[model samples]
Target: MKMLPSKNLLMTLLTAWIALFTSSYFFYWQITFSSQFTHVFVGCLMLLLIGFVYVKNDFVEFEMFNLKEK
Candidate 1:
């Protein structure tokens, strides 16, 4: 039987996908929002925050599993 993916791996993959999508979306509208530096910066900051949370949650889950197995 095949095993399911770990939380960390899934979160990493999702974060990558989200980053790519956000970058492409911003790039696509670059011409229209060329002067919106604050918006772009805020968007990037939010994405980073989201990624950090996911990674942290994954780490916590991993730790919990390890503790349970011991």
Candidate 2:
């Protein structure tokens, strides 16, 4: 089987998209419920960190899911 072009780029883009979406959701949550900017910022940071860790650990598995070896 032939490999897809820019596989790494695709993986990176997916990871970034996940991270951004998660962090944005958390930020929105914080802003909706929290009155303080500090709290919202902290929540956003935490969510982003968590997303980064998740993506770092799972990206390889995710990439491998659709990849076929020749």
Candidate 3:
């Protein structure tokens, strides 16, 4: 199986790192997100995104077709 593309891998890691730092900051400070519901929603979405990216990177491979999607 072929590896994931470098550009896509960098982007995925970058997004996950930003999300991880942001969420960790909030959790570390024990901030109440009751008033900032949007942050909570975004955090949850980012969590799923991070998990998906991690799984895809580690366990999945994409089919290549002339260097682009088929």
The number of the candidate with the highest TM-score is 1
Q: Which candidate is the best by lDDT?
A: 1
Q: How far out, in Å, is residue 52 in model 3?
A: 23
The weakest ten consecutive residues by lDDT in model 3 span 58-67
What tens digits encode model 1's per-residue C-alpha lDDT throughout 1-70?
9999999999999999999999988887645565687779899999999999999999999999999999
Cα RMSD for predicted model 1: 9.2
Off by over 4 Å in 1: 1-35
Where is model 3 more than 4 Å wrong at Cα?
1-5, 29-70
Cα RMSD (Å) per model? 9.2, 12.9, 11.8
If candidate 2 were superposed on the true structure by all CA atoms, what would the RMSD be?
12.9
Q: List the residue pairs that clash in candidate 2.
A: none
Query: What is the Cα-based TM-score of model 3?
Result: 0.37
lDDT of 2 by residue, 1-70 (tens): 9878698999999999999999988776634444677778899999999999999879887778758552
| Candidate 2 local lDDT, residue 18 | 100
**Candidate ranking (lDDT, best to worst):** 1, 2, 3
Question: Sorted on TM-score, highest at the top, how do the candidates line up?
Answer: 1, 2, 3
lDDT values, one for every candidate? 0.92, 0.83, 0.80
Instruction: Look at candidate 3 and tell me the lDDT of residue 36.
Output: 72
